[model samples]
Target: MPELGGPTSAPALLRPHDPAPPLLDAARLGVAAHRGLDVEALLTWTTDTADLLPLPGTGSTAALWSALASVAAADVGAARVLEPHLDALAVLAQAPTPVDLGAVGAGGSSTWGVFAAEGPGVRLEAHEVDGGWRLTGTKPWCSLAGTLSHALVTAWVSDDERRLFAVGLRADDVLPAAGPWVSRGLAQVVSAPVTFDDAPAVPVGPPGWYLRRPGFAWGGIGVAACWWGGAVGLARALWDALGAREADQLALAHLGAVDVALTAARACLVEAADQVDAGIDGKPSAVLARRVRTVVAGAVEEVQRRCAHALGPGPLTADEAFARRVADLGVYVRQHHAERDEAALGRDLLAAGVAPW
Candidate 1:
């Protein structure tokens, strides 16, 4: 909602409907459902509201990020589930081969997730059969594997090359394994391994294209937007609590610190979205994504720490939503890859010979 560009700039296109309403309303409705770890309710909400979200880098990039952030603010777990689905759609949209979006759950009848993570001793290999691809072996970190009807997954074409493919989860050969997920945060959304036994797939993009695409970096930054939103939610809780009582200087100072961290992170996100639309700087998108993710991740950590220090044990112990939020965000932001990402960014900059201001 804040200025995505300069003072004189207007939104390239007006978002058809505000992304916050459906997510916030779902958050309120899902509070009770969360206790039961109701996965269906979340899926229903995702399918019903999927159309409201816009594709990233499509001039209205800020709106898309705003929607992702709103979802995180409302419910981190919901954001966890929904973000990948949206990312998958965007991935398909960006693919060189034209895809029938409706075939991949864009019709509001099904849900989707992205399963691209590869693990040690496990590989999902894609073999060309009858001029088509069939994914075999296991894929790790397939979130919502049991519930989602489709996924945009990555499988190795050769020893070192991997390509993205769209596969239907409802197919007879797709097997979603049970157990191994026991985190308190995102308790409802289980991310376990899934094995594909000669499962038919449609290649979304050519080998090496998935990670090389600019949208890959944009998707990573979009996750950071969720981190920013999660921080916002925590900061809001701290503010509300402080307002109810005469707060001491320490508590108020923590709030101030929170505001500072969030503002800077938000500014970075806005600028990144603007760059994406305005034809991003000559620098690689990986560089931009790393910078934004690092900033937002720091903000998330700061806000969580400040909120805890300012409010003490009261909210963590008595406020269910607050406690769940804290836990969910703690788990969710780990996607940033912390020190390794920072180091990669440093290495990239050094190689590029970019001067740091």
Candidate 2:
């Protein structure tokens, strides 16, 4: 596994460490700040590596997904901090081979982590500006606000065409608003609401670019990897903590179970990545993507819950890693696709009387 902050020849930024842990208390606000900075650095590193971009004929999507999953599992706030990079990823996929990770990171890494398009609380809109584009709206769940450099936001072009854009975090372009993301769980994400009063933006590609491509499916797989990583991390933490305790048997059993679950999830991720690389487009790939998401989500939840119980309450309360893993798992598992949608896909496959393999 790649170390979080190892030295590299890439033009990415590096985060310095702080003595305090972000979640300790109000006095540890500095820790949160430091964490946010670290997250930005990590995002830069990710965006700098062309391997992180999905390319034609490159069977590397699974690897990238796994890496992103590890980061999200370790720190969801950091994952959020990298949202702009994710957007730039979509653009990178359309660009030439040997992708310019530095350009992608520099273009969008900052604002992407702080912008949102889902849920009823956030609204985003964009219009063509002189040379770039103008974004006007508010986004809820803007994670890593104080740290992110730009946001890749989605907005309507005349209320019909949905376009994606990269917007810089200029003082004149964005307005900060109070947010409701104060849950004790996933608190490190620090998602807040952002209001855009005619914010300036830059169009990434043609209209309906994101929704019309396989990039969305690929993005979903990346997120699934993150949740899977979190689950694996939680399981590892629990197993290590209780390996020598009286509940050793239970811990062993849980560890075995978690390993199986994670392995299965990884298999699915690899398969999905292969299919994507092979240009297996449309509903079949979409169905497989959904299945991957569902399986990963279920496996991670099971691992987190069981591992937490196996470790007992003492470790849960005192171990920052364990506690954060649990909280991160809780927040990530909710991104599961609707059961009915997944089941409908299964039903269609079954009715076809053909092996989906």
lDDT of each: 0.79, 0.58
Candidate 1, residue 246: CA error in Å? 0.6
Runs of candidate 2 with Cα error greater than 4 angstroms are: 1-57, 72-87, 95-111, 114-116, 129-132, 246-249, 337-357
* After superposition, candidate 1 runs with Cα above 4 Å error: 1-37, 100-108, 281-283
For candidate 2, the 10 contiguous residues with the lowest summed lDDT are 6-15
> Candidate 2, 245: how far from true, in Å?
3.4
Question: On a 0 to 100 scale, what is the lDDT of residue 283 in model 1?
Answer: 55
Best by lDDT: 1
TM-scores of the candidates in the order shown: 0.89, 0.75
Winner by TM-score? 1
